[model samples]
Target: MPKAVLALGANQGDPARQLALAGAAIAAHPDIEVLAESSVIVTPPWGKTDQAEFHNAALLIETGLSPLDLLDFCLATEAGIGRVRLEKWGPRVIDIDLIAYDRLEMESERLTLPHPYAHQRDFVLTPLREIAPDIADWLVNRIGTSSA
Candidate 1:
């Protein structure tokens, strides 16, 4: 099994409850095993800052699914949670991002391992640091320290 990191966030419609629902969905997946989860934290909106603050958390999991499959699962999970792609960086009901997949590094039309912007976002890094400090440290160091 390969370990992967995921970042979860919601800024609309009961943010905390939305995160809890996402956690449940992830745990319900037969091919995935939840390893650790970070405490949910409130973060000011990023990208498009006009929305409400977001509830954010991170998850560490061991899974039998391939990276692309995991990405698809995330997308499906978001849609299941009522996410609508109305705008880029727009407010969302739930957002699940596959931040990293083992030590793999690759980018295709649908997915990218070691999420290109994870290091630059504190909402992603802070919760990740709580459950997986080493991975968080590596991401920060790997990408020249984060200013967030």
Candidate 2:
């Protein structure tokens, strides 16, 4: 099983419900096995704080899927939950981001493995750090390891 980490967030609708549904959606995939899911962390906002508060959580997953497969899962989850990617960092109904993938490094026009901005954003790092401070610290220390 390839280890992976995902960040789950919601702000538009019932966040708790969205979070649960997102987890369920991920688990619905036969290849994705959830190891441990961190408790939801409610935060103010990131890029656009003017919108709404966000409920965030980190999910440790094990999957046989490739990086691109995981990215497609995330995008599909967002679309399934009615996410409109109109504005940059705007309000969202649901947002699922692949934070890490078994130390994999990938760069594509569609997505970047080990999310480019995972460290700087408190929304991503805080809940992540809570679930895994050591990994979070490493990501912070190794910011320049990738294109970030």
Candidate 3:
């Protein structure tokens, strides 16, 4: 199995509860094992600043699923939790982001490894730094480089 980092956030319908349910759901997946999780933090809205603040955290997991499969898994988890893509960076019941996957790097229509914006978002990097500091380092080192 390969290790990956997932960032979680929620701004509506009891954000804290949403994160708890999401963590449990992810951990319950057959192809995934939750190795570690971070404490959630409150952050102001990012791209879309008109919404409420968000509760953010990250998780380290060991998974047998491939990158795209894992992405699909997260999306399904979000939908199961009543998430809707009403707006970009808008408020939601839950938001799950695959921050990194076993040092793999690639881009496709549906997903991107080492998420294209992970290097620049404090909300993403803060919790991610908690469970996997090395990944935080990789995100920072990629900054200002061609890949970023």
Candidate 4:
């Protein structure tokens, strides 16, 4: 099974509730077994800061599902929670993003893993480091080892 991390967020209509509900839904999926979860954190909107504050959490999952299939599941889960894709980084009922999948890098029109901004965004790195401290350390440790 491939281990994957998903970043969940919501900012409209009971943001926290929406996030929790989506987490449950993702866990219930047949191929997805949620291994760990992070506490919800409230963050000022990132790209679109004008929108409502976001409630964010990260999920660690073990799954047999492929990347595209996992993305489909995420999309379906978002829609199930009344998520509206109105604007990029805008208000949403629930937003589920496949942040990483066992160090896999995938880029396509629909999704990107190890999300493009994963390294740059504190909101993402903080929770990831908290949940997978070893992986976090390995990443940072690699920076200088390349020249060693």
Residue 30 lDDT, candidate 2, scale 0-100: 93
TM-score list, all predictions = 0.95, 0.92, 0.96, 0.88
Better by lDDT, candidate 4 or 1: 1
Tens-digit lDDT track for model 1 on 7-79?
A: 9999999989899999999999999999999999998998988989999999999999999999999999999
> lDDT by residue for model 2 over 9-121, one digit each (tens)?
99987988988999999999999998878888889888877988999998888998888988898899889988889888888889999988877777889877668888787
Clashing pairs in 1: none
lDDT of 2 at 97: 90
What shift in Å separates residue 20 of candidate 2 from its native position after superposition? 0.6
Task: Judging by TM-score, tell me the better candidate of 1 and 2.
Answer: 1
* Residue runs of model 4 more than 4 Å from their true location after superposition: 136-148
In model 4, pairs of residues that clash are none
Model 3, span 25-123: residue lDDT tens: 999999999999999999998998998999999999999999999999999999999998987888899999998998888889998888888888899
Query: Total clashes, candidate 1?
Result: 0
- The Cα error of candidate 2 at residue 84, in Å, is 1.7
lDDT of predicted model 2? 0.85
Q: If both were scored by lDDT, which would come out higher, candidate 3 or candidate 4? A: 3
TM-score of 2: 0.92
- How are the candidates ranked when ordered by lDDT, highest leading? 1, 3, 2, 4
Give me the displacement of residue 93 in model 1, in angstroms.
0.5
Model 3: runs farther than 4 Å from truth?
none
